[model samples]
Target chain A: MSDHAVSRRAFLRAGGAVLTGTLASTSGVLALIAPSTSWALELEALDAHQGATVLQFTRHVFPHDRLDDAVYALVVKDLDAGAAEDPTTRRMLIDAVRRLDEASGGEWLSRSAAEQFVQVQAMEATPFFVKVHSTAVVSLYDNDMAFAHFGYPGRKGDPGYIHRGFNDLHWLPDPPDGASGPVPETA
Target chain B: MDMYDNRTTFAADDDGVVVVIGSGAGGGTLANELAQKGVDVVLLEAGGLHTTDEFIADEWPSFSQLAWTDTRTTMGDWRVARDFPNLPAWICKAVGGTTVHWAGASLRIEPHEFRARSTYGDLAGATLRDWPLSADDLASYYDTAEKKLNVTRTNGLPGLPANNNFKVMHAGATRLGYETCHTGRMAINSVNKDGRNHCMQRGFCFQGCRYAAKWSTLYTEIPAALQTGRVELRTRVHVARIDHDDNDRVTGVVYFDADGRERRQAARVAAVAGNSIETPRLLLNSESSRFPNGLANGSDQVGRNYMRHTTGTVWGVFDKPVEMYKGTTMAGIVQDEARHDPKRGFVGGYEMETISLGLPFMAAFFNPGGWGRGFTEAMEQYRHMAGMWLVGEDMPQADNRVTLSSEARDAFGLPVANVHYTDHANDVAMREHAYTRGAAIYEAAGATRTYRTPPYPSTHNLGTCRMSERAADGVCNGHGQSHELANLFISDGSQFTTSAAENPTLTIVTLAIRQADYIAERMRARAI
Candidate 1:
């Protein structure tokens, strides 16, 4: 069990106010909102409980401390859309939450974060978990929020990094001068 | 540049024109060189044309925009077949083919690599054969190719400045007592020349260079060929089969246009350059009564001896940040390992090139189906990581091949190519040694951790329709002409007799240039 899972569980225990829209305000609706971020999503096929479990499962799979719940929400948003269109996918996710609840002695969301981690780990190789894990791997890291958090400055603006310190490494000792050697002639 | 002649279309019965089936490093350059010799050519590309401006900076989107996402299958015990079962080779289908996605490391094949069978001797289960021509035969052509591509470290062009990734590799290689490390000979321009802009170090070499700094046939050869007014470039045209006459000589090609309408274009000469897999697939699908097995497959060697270089990735994590993706995707090299020595437990050698993957690609490919804290912790240190790619000659096995799949049929109702491969013993030893050396380099450079990643989908595909001097030994002759059919030619890496330790683009282009001269001379003598 990671610290992130514990903190996320602590936020959810406080009357679930962290997820405000359609989660805290409305009842019996499938929706979620990131704790500190302004990102929110509504599921068309999955229930509120199923959607929340998918979010929790994605975070447990990738579990980065610096990333907000919003990054994991991106995975939930995609999985929810997939569930909305495909009945097979919807059933798979619904069955996934049911199994998780059973594994956690019924009502997975109310279980301790450590127990939830064990439950997710036990089902990591299942088709339902594989779908969520694979989708989360791409959706979590490819976006802007993950880029900023991971310190990957993807694609500099305008003319690229030609003049913007492409070779600025001050930590290591520099190599001997002309270490690249001379140019070969075509003739 | 108004490079495409959209208003022009060759007639179905135009037998005087040479039809090139694929627009890529081989076909594109061959078409332009042939047109320069007053020959008419029809360059057919399976994918649509994407100009430089349309190229995106992102990874997944660029892959979708350029990759050859055809319905193909893979078999055998290779890692690619297990990791990426559907995608065996990472070549492109667009106008420029894989050249659009290449990292621009243009290296010439070493002299000894051309005579692999003779120098390395016969090893068990390895179907090694010496090339029909030596490096001396290709030296002039290589010179021409280097100048045409405006490759750095040649023609007095300066090498690219050492980026952070290169600095890490240089320091590590120097510490390891490897003296042949450098910024490498890359096709990406270090200065503005040849009407193309210099490299901006944009770090997306595999996703189509947006500034035209890296040489791609999409902007260089195809456009130049179209400007000759003797060439017709067609896009979104999928070639299905090569048609032959009663004499067993190739006469035309059958293809499906963008609208899925079947069209036939007659040709005096038909050159196949659809990379290794499809080149053999097209020939096998064109089986006729005169040539029952396949066109030019007299020895039944149309799709055997498949080789994708023994490759793997190594990433070193350090306390200090090494922003790898801040410059060219592949910017440096250590050439000392690229020499044959049987004492090293491998018949051939490998090169260690500096490589960088953006965050999206890294997550997707670092370890497919990898997760947990062990995986995320390494990825979390993305800013502090430096990467290198190990590419070496993998011995060709007769059973490792690309055959027609009976299960998977493409959109054009043609059976797709099923690529089957298994790593040979030499390949396994070479990769293991390279991994140990790569890890040692990182450890010498004060690394905290190192990850030896399995090879990604093959970007260095070679040897399916191979060349040979004897007709009974292989498919094509020294000039890439079909041993049985004088009018048929193979103008791609498919004609490689043996896989070399160097990159194949420069060699493929060199062969295409030499083939063009042979084709022109034969046409003048009324040979075909």
Candidate 2:
């Protein structure tokens, strides 16, 4: 497939899955888990239960309507490796997950979205929360896959952005006469 | 086009050549100017030469590729130290230095700004001094530098087209009855000239302009100097210290090559331009029995009065999708507030320039440790954000300086430079005023919400080994030649006597062009 075509397909899938996930929890969980299963199974740092908690935690930190489990999984993979190397990071992640469950009365995953959000909020300023939030912010948003979801056409190179949407602003009124004009093509 | 003489071999005893350390705006421009005057120069740059083809357009990746990222320590009450401890200055560790990563805002120092001491008067807790050289002394040189860099809005080149972020800024400025809003006078080209392409508006000005539209010394001065056949650019040669003779005259530079092997390049005259941090550190490290306090540091002011511009960003969320990241990173500016008005609770002034950060950087810097719903909402409204950066004159404080950290050691086992900064009362007041005015402008343009961000890692590092008329006041003289050592010169912003309310690159290049003329004249006269 062409590069644009592949990006379009990913865009469509990301839109459908994330929108469905937002509307209903059961369907949302299924939609999130389907494409992310292979990556989830490859977790080296966290066990299945801990990985699931981390996945949920990342979504809360960034929490976009269009973001999918795959974007969050990028954060999970990095965190997993970090935890594997550092004993402090490993202990923080495991303990944070346990605390969330205890706070939610063992309904951390099945609880209402509002309740789970509150549990995450209570863990704010904690080392575990800060670690997860900081890592996920970069890993989740810094990916090309996530860029597609947000409608960010990453990096226009080669035949640059000049003749493209760079100057196209339909929302803005036309600039005052002589303030700006179309760039003359150079020979 | 033999535009490179990558000298792999230079004898240690070659003292006839002039050695310039740090090939950025200052050193690069100076090297080219001196070479054109038939002077042989050995330009030693600590970083690798990454050409335009190696530049990526992404934020994080480009930062990794371009940022200094050396093992430096930060010990200041400033937010940058707390948020970004390791990366103190956002300069480049490449051939062109920070010019490779700058946003191409080229501005001249205002007439009054050259004499901050006379204009602002003696303020408490500030070390303000009038530049020994005035704006008039540098005006002709600024013109020359502008022509060399192809700075737009001059020499008949048109200003850049206004992008969405600029449009938003214009709309707001017009609504607020502020008149001086326009696409800025940038060094980035509006038309192809001097064997370089016009800007393609790739919106990655900070990530190394691949189009070569934005003038960087890496592509412009460095190549031009080499083509003269009088310049040799030695990249990845980190200068450790400036060596001087018993007479306290600079004789050579001791450096580490790409293989971590110690090498010495003898020089008749040595010019240091390794930014503010490293420049002072080098002088301090080069202490000898003759000048124990550091060479040419008789004033004991080698690393004093460090100043980064008082900077912050305010992002305005509008009802419409501004799509701020579609054009040049910072093309538009509102200069209405740049006038010095002490009645507004600040001693100095600031410029409100339209700025845009990519999604990844915006998330990291919007609030350093920010998370939760508010942060998420800002990220979700990324498409609807219009941002403006406030670049203003910050006070020069003796206590806020770059000092050699006794604890931290760099890769070469040398004491790493520790930057310590505290926002002066003047700086704090100026920032508050700028924030208020910035938010008001966006609000006038119908912004639904606005968020203020603290200062990020500074790209504009200035004033550590500043120029002074008196030897006891600063390190260098008006001509950038060291006060105590005639053959030693400072060719970077480190020689700035006072931080002005303008971007420092143009002034740095202007000073370098002027310094080269003086160096050539002095060589003929045998003044040293």
Candidate 3:
């Protein structure tokens, strides 16, 4: 099949992804046997029954819209994937999220959106919060590098002046209030 | 006790000179260009001479130094970027601004980026407009900038060998009807220029280039500005206010040195060169009865129209080791979506980029979930991780603005910049459109996993002091001259009319050079 044909099919499948529906349809046996999540220690980072981690963990079980779950999970997966392991990194990650959950007093998933935002901002003040945020952005950047690896489009173009009407903007309205301060047009 | 308390005033009997605030790319270049012509200058910068040694391999310390240390920073509902506690909006207050730690992906505005507003009309709740300057007007300046900053990355040899990734993007482009366009043009030196060597493909350009291959103000303009001996750089000096007379012309500036004691210097003219975000923050923070609503803010537009191009990225896994982390942070780009697409539902386009990956520790914390042994399996796949992002145009919104929060104060006792913004439906729609396009490319590249993210904060913030033909219509005029103050000018992104899809460093540099000519001519006429 053509490349377009394949991704379109995958995208269509990736969409219409109802989490509850998938959970209901898939048996726990199937969930346990998923490719990316076969390891027990990987699932034990957080108190699995707790607040946001539980929601976040389940969200990761079946990748959907919440990019962080997949991103964070994959980061841990990759760090340990290599032969040279860094245990401190793992401890920091688990501790960071747990502290974040606890500092908010376990009201993560149940908190109002506004409160969640407030707590998230406060957490960001900590190095752990900054670490997660930066890691997520960095992961996304890595993702882009991979696209470039295979040759992608859209990363081309100049830094500024992306306007189509760049030439026709000649209809420069006279200065507001008719105060023609120094425009010094460059011909 | 707060830091910078040892700041002391230095009064020179010589009172004739122009003062440029925030000596990064914009201020640094303008200062050099003007100083080369024998104009005395005082450049104020908040961050100090942080040598490369101060830089660690970690992202936190590096980011705090490279990114905006401003605590009031926040990212509002920018999808995946919302994960950032603060605004993913990163800009440095250092000598070179963000260029001190940029991926070195400097590209010029395509002929289209300068006039999105005229082509697309008023986008929903956003205020997009035509810049007073044209791409043709900036063409010469871009070349001059290229020569000075060594913007010569692609010298024939294809950047990023045609991997499965490019194959996909190319196929997607051909399928999506963007065949006329190809890869992006960058400021990276593919070949040596003017005594600088080509990029070593070190992939750590953002941490401050040592070989001088990367063009940062610290490497180029500041050295030149200092060479002229007409420019005085005050590192770690935090400018507090632009003092103005009854006539509203900036007469001098007050600042605190790194040690934090008060000091002031007189000036013949003042150019605020801090980039879009903090430039306006400084102006709005400076309040006086003579310029009641803040210096040069007669129309109350000092910090209005804050913007960031709605960035979208498509990520997936490939089967091979692309080794994308080996070269300059950004060596390739996609320009197919570089223009406004009326049919695409927004007046903006996006620039797709091939970004580099992080080191082991950095990547470890960032790789997507699965742990211990499973995580190790993913590490083996680290060489396969691939992605691309399209920086689509975002409109200038009056209500989506930056204001000094009365309650929020920074370490300097200055009010913090409170960004009030919500992604306009148009920007969000464009983000979706760009992501869909990116995802198509990823799938074409034979991606086993694919997803789209609406970016929250990545540098490239502009339009807080948007330019317009009218004074009341914008905080500054087409020349970036403060509408209310005759002797005040801005050489930063704050004066942009619309946030272009491309990274803004080159544009900021071009405008600074252009402003130098304008200010010089004006000063020559007045014999200042």
Candidate 4:
């Protein structure tokens, strides 16, 4: 997608390395070094299709927040595992996305990347879906040093959170600037 | 988020004579009080501050940085995260806590709200009843809290420039013969108080007030408490458990440091102010062989009786512009219907209020119904868009509780708060009634378009660790102390006995001040 920064493969590589502690500060939101083997297995599980689906889904659910590699690593790990531990939450998120795609007359997983990105947030009212989207949404747009870890918002060294500092980078999308999608009908 | 790095252990080398957990209304005011009383205090906050600068212009960014938590992921039941299937509820995790984005309307609990059981004792699937304390007990405190927060009544302000939405709401209430008054007791500075400026009528309270008009802990109590130098605020330390000795005495707290380092601090006593979900989770996580059922959990009631403000909303479009978002967070409240209306078949009551909504999210979400151009048209008539809420009462159900998840953990290896709440029958009825009433009000006000948002989980979570005289009957006591552990206390909305039809910041502050006084007395006796 024109808006995306790194390719899915590059993200996978960087995230995988960071998860395994081989790399450090990938995107610099969170310096969380997830277990190495766990991340390796996660990358293998997503392959390419899953990654693409996530990007598209994220575009709609969190057009405002950033979805860099770190967030991908975190969220992907949860999805690959099917959210068994958090069944209710898992079902809610899945259903929300499913509903969003259905509202668009297409399947989120199967639609064109651009198409999926537009309607992924249609079902945001679903509780579990809201939580999932919130995780990525805040990470995407919130600018701060400590927020880099898991792409959270708020500045680091705030003396308030677990992480101290981050890149203080902002990942907002350019405004309509004239080249944009059609405005929807009023509900 | 982890146990080892928990900041709840506010005992540093400078362990103040007192320590307050959380920097929200309750903790902030209590800390200030203790400091004023010449007691050293440490105010420990789980969330950090969002500077006035970071409060730029977008709703989402402001919400993430200054609102609650960035991560939507919650702690699961036990050490597992069973992210609830389809129930999304929001709770802030910053220094200001939920106050940062709160719609600052404060209301005193009705006398009847104190004893729901006495008035509404027959509700099914609940321990619905009156509060152990009374409104009268909190009356003086409410007045004191109001003054400290610089609350202003909104009955009659200058040309508020009523949009179609306001007219609709006013006409509807008049037609219904309800005692609909302008929302009152806002924490906004109608005039300068101390050094903070007044409300600029920006309709952006939840986005982190830029001019410091709203009464968030950051702008109010926390700053005052910090002024004493007797108070030290340590943010980002995520506490996991309350460390105790063999006799069941709490020594201090254990938490993971911000750098992910595990650490422990010693204290004479501990207070659980981490809100409904986190407070009980902390009590449960502080398990030891001596306190097997969990710290102060010998009664097994540490995490029970969760309640959310029974809430519903009515959105409508008026022919004229109602700059709803151009004032204080909440301008007024309707308390006539705020009692346990059993004839209506519900366990709780409802509070009605006028709220703000900018064009972006509110207009888009409640744009009369569908997607695309339809949504756009709704925006074109932004002035016509208006929203009102019926904050109903939710009964407490054991099944609806907050517990630690077993299967999942946050980045830090700690259990998450697993909340299990389903709307009760009464709650359902109340929501329906509120929607109907809201619709009628909009119609009376001549709204061209109208709609209702029903029974969603509100951010104002309360009543997880209810207070009772007996440990067997409740998690904490009248003073908000653990039933089993005399030295342990609670200082947040978690100790709410009943969900009143009002914002809880004031109630929580009053209760916390009472607890602080009790703590001071006990400290003098060395019982702490």
Candidate 5:
């Protein structure tokens, strides 16, 4: 098992009070104090503050040329669910977020993307970093949106790639004649 | 054609049927061949019968649908143990087995590979042995298998067009002054044949071909066997143990149905083709008072001598985008290095085959726990990567074995298989040589950077239940029959005497085709 294989039961028990306290200021208060307000109270696994931290953390881990926050949010959704289920993951994320804030001189969430990127890089070897990075690597690029954004011709169905861009290599120089020629019709 | 679903129950006392325990290349092909010969066969597959339509082109979801994600423990000093301990072998659980997830690299083992012990001489700490039957004995069977699979570049079918990945490899191989670089002889269709569609070059060959262009038994052999009306394929029937009679001959199989109910299907002759891992695990778990050491395991080699090919991947970063994931996962090969050259510091040789993984898989497997600028930069150049996989002949060590784990129990409460492996000195040397050569090939082709990835979870599992001329040497005989029990047979890659450099699927299919004839003859003669 990986080091991130945290005890879900232990985490839920130990952090139950902390999670309730965190939610009290956000969703709990929104429900009691401003139930009829124009703002819809969004119920998420992670608190608004933690969710913001993770979204920023994921983008820094896998910063692309043109990837936006919407793309990185896909990863946050999974992490939020994971933190909800496994208290260890929740605690880890909370602790890591606090440490990042301290490392950024108490301006992690308010700091520039460049400063936040350095903080994430400094803690690359941490379990929180590994868990989030590994999770985001798959969650971020596995969608149809990511494929289109990266210009990857997603899986071929129906007609297949034979008549498509299977052999269309206009970007490359032509090889020797026989290199791309028809295969010999013999054993 | 008669196809029975798991819902259709079979009687526990019906002992007249020939029961095959898997439905991949070995079991599926064997069932079809036996059915063609007017024999009654009941093929039991542990997974559902997922058709081509159910195949998702996406990597992770397809993996969830196709991969055998059973709880199998991994031990020893091998890299896979550290990186992918839960998934030791990347085989499929679906009806077609691993064939559905294969890259379709159809290659015959070289003649010298069949005589590994005699040709390579003695090596320290290696349990090398020559196959009981030579390549000459299997020539006709290979020819038949090639025709059955409709392998490209054979039977008047042209090869697949070279993709950009292949073009990169071709330029590198040419610069290295090595010939024989071409679109490989793949089981994937280059043109329409056998009522299946031609190669679409969909690039997700590992994720199950949606077009049925790849020769998977799910779409090919299993369907053909069903058409014969002499075979019954029951999916989601996981065999737990093989039952033997008083004389220690396998009489039937006891398995769990899809609903987790225990059921027994009696057999006249039971052939175990549940791959190398589960095949030996089933036999070992079948230990009775008569066969105390497990059925046909008197030589103590039933689960010993497990061999996965010496494998790694080398990726080249070019200035221009390669778009490697546009064609078939693997379509080209450089066979120049697949020769017996002891001077290269390793007794056996390897093949450099073109391979491409989608960005999702590449990120997960490129460097398992990698991060930072180096890792992020690689992903940034995902479209500019050209990669090739190195598959070499790894020495089979006695210590590198598969045993029943007393600690980890599977979903069925049965003890899961514990795969333990340590790289032999020969394997280490071979990998080092291949890495250097691979990096040089990329450099010669103007690659700015080349990254050598460590070995991932094995797909080419072989040589757990090997064939030997003498009963004392191995678990099975030349015809894949258990040496101790006449009615029991070992199918799949487990019957390989030595792990050859070539992909084992082609040979496994050929052996199954040949074994069907031998089994039919024995049944006729009443040899047992």
Candidate 6:
């Protein structure tokens, strides 16, 4: 298939295979496991539960109805790698998960989506929340799966859209040809 | 048959060479113009070279790669200070300077803007001044700059085709009884001209146009200057200080090379074009016993009167998919509001130009520190949103200045610039008027909901080192020569007397072309 014809499902399926490949490259440093059928994670420093909470937190920060959980897991991958590189990041992630559980009556994962959102909102001003949100805001949305889900045409225009659908916005009324006024004799 | 020369080097002790710092619209054009006249020059640029082929397509990665990521601190009541405290300006650090990141909206300053102090009279707390020269003095040079840059809608070049974003802006502008709206006078090519490729609607103007369609000095004037074999272009050379002789005439520059070794290059003249912030910081850092206050800073106006245009963004969410990011980043403009009508509850004027940010930048700048359902829902309409940037003339204030930071230091161990700014009352009123009018344009175009975002980091960045008729009033004369030091010149937007309601690249190049002619004439007359 042409590169443009690759659908969102195909993109996510390719992402899963890439994750399996990453598990081998990070053999000593990382451990891979499938907690659910929809998505799998290979985490370095963050544990399974810590990685899952970060994924959930990223979803609340940028909740797209059409994006898959695997797309949101990209944020977890980045956060996990950062945590592995720095002990401060690891401590912040661990402390943030603790605060969430305490806020949600010591059973944050067991609570409803509404209850989890309230806990996330209460910690919006925290440094950990700011760090995760800032990282995820760029990480999650910049990947191919999120771009496909959001209908953002990726940066594929080399020769560009001059001969393609550049002027194909037929929804709005056609403006007058002479709407561009006279060219002033500047030179 | 040689169209270019990529290799040219100058000796460090070459005293006869004219040294021009920072290769943007000003210094790049000035260097080339002098080289074309057979004058030897050495152009020193702080950033490394990245040609069109090295340009990136992605937003976040490209911004990280191209943006001036040096240390800077901002303090003010302006929202940008709270939103982006460390990054006060969004200029490029690459060899072409901010010209690589510019939107190609080339416009000449309106005639009335040249005499702002006389036109607007005394505003209560503003210290505005008239330019030493008039519009007539720069008209022929503007004509030369427009042709050299191949600005569309002039010199018989056709304007770029209107995109969906422009159509949205046009529909709203027409419905509001406003005239003078169209695809703008862009420096981007509409057809193949001057051996460069035409724009292909690539939709990534800010990431450095890979096709060389947009006019950046990196691909144009710098190479042309080298082709003459009269210029030596050195990248990764950061100038630390401008050294002067006993007579207080600038004689050479002290700089650190790529290896971080201290070196000095002797020069017959020194022209500074490191944008507004760094230009003033360089002058202030070069304090000596002879000129203890700073070189050419006898009037204490070197770091004063900074101006970034009053700017904001208004995004409109429509029911249908607009696909706003399909064409050029900024292709459309509305000029009806760009007039000095005091009845609009403010002095000066503003221009509304169609702008698009990629999904990554949109999320980061949409609300800055916003989250929750309201933020996500607005972002959900990414494919259905149309956006426009409102840029009005901001007042030049003495206190809105760039000073050397007391605590922060750069890699070279120099104090970084601390940019302090607050909106003048007139600036506040102008932004409010522009924001309301900008939102109304989108609303008239059938937007279901509209989002008004505060200004991001400044892209305009002007008027720190200003020009005036009298030596006591400003730093430079009409010719951009320093009043106290004849051989020193301010060759960038930093010399702007007033921040006119126009994009500055065209005017910056025009002034450089004029400054080149003046410098060449002075050399011939045996005058420094």
Which candidate would rank higher by DockQ, 1 or 5?
A: 1
Q: What is the lDDT, from 0 to 100, of the residue B147 in candidate 1? A: 96
Off by over 4 Å in 1: A1-36, A181-187, B6-8
On the 0 to 100 scale, the lDDT of residue B4 in model 2 is 58
- In order, candidate lDDTs are 0.87, 0.85, 0.61, 0.60, 0.83, 0.86
**Which model, 1 or 6, shows the larger lDDT?**
1
TM-score of every prediction relative to native: 0.94, 0.93, 0.71, 0.71, 0.90, 0.93
* Model 3 whole-model lDDT (C-alpha atoms): 0.61
Which has the better lDDT: candidate 5, or candidate 6? Answer: 6
DockQ of 5: 0.30
What DockQ results for candidate 2?
A: 0.37
> Chain A TM-score, candidate 5?
0.68
TM-score of chain B of each: 0.99, 0.98, 0.89, 0.89, 0.98, 0.99
Q: Write the per-residue lDDT of candidate 5 for residues B310-352, one digit (tens) a residue.
A: 9999999998878888788896988888999999999989999
User: Candidate 4's C-alpha lDDT?
Assistant: 0.60
Q: What lDDT is obtained when candidate 2 is compared to the true structure?
A: 0.85
Off by over 4 Å in 6: A1-38, A180-187, B1-7
Off by over 4 Å in 4: A1-187, B1-17, B70-87, B154-168, B363-381, B455-457
For every prediction, compared with the true complex, DockQ reads 0.33, 0.37, 0.03, 0.03, 0.30, 0.29
Interface RMSD of each candidate, angstroms, one decimal: 4.1, 2.1, 17.3, 18.2, 3.6, 4.3
Put the candidates in lDDT order, highest first.
Answer: 1, 6, 2, 5, 3, 4
Candidate 3 lDDT over A31-133, as tens digits, reads 3334432222232223333313433432332223322333344433333222113345545655656665686687466666556555555654565444444
Error of 6 at B240 (Å): 0.6
Comparison by TM-score, 5 against 6, better one: 6
lDDT of 6 by residue, B284-317 (tens): 9999997787788999998899999999999999
Candidate 1 C-alpha lDDT tens digits along B109-153: 999999999999999999999999999999999999999999888
Q: Best candidate per lDDT, number? A: 1
Share of reference contacts kept by candidate 2: 0.45
- Chain A, candidate 4, TM-score of 0.39
Candidate 2 lDDT by residue in tens digits, B1-528: 445555333467888788999999999999999999998899999999889999987889888888899888888799889888988888998999989988989999999998899999998999999999998999899999999888878888888888888888888888889888888889988888889998887888889998899999999999888887788899888899898888878889999999999998899999999999999999988888887887788888988899999999998999878888887888689898999998998887899988888878888888988777788888888888999999999999999888888898878888889999999999999999999999998998889989999998998899999999999999999899999889999999999999999989999999999999999999989875
RMSD of 1: 6.3
Residue B273 CA error for candidate 2 (Å)?
0.7
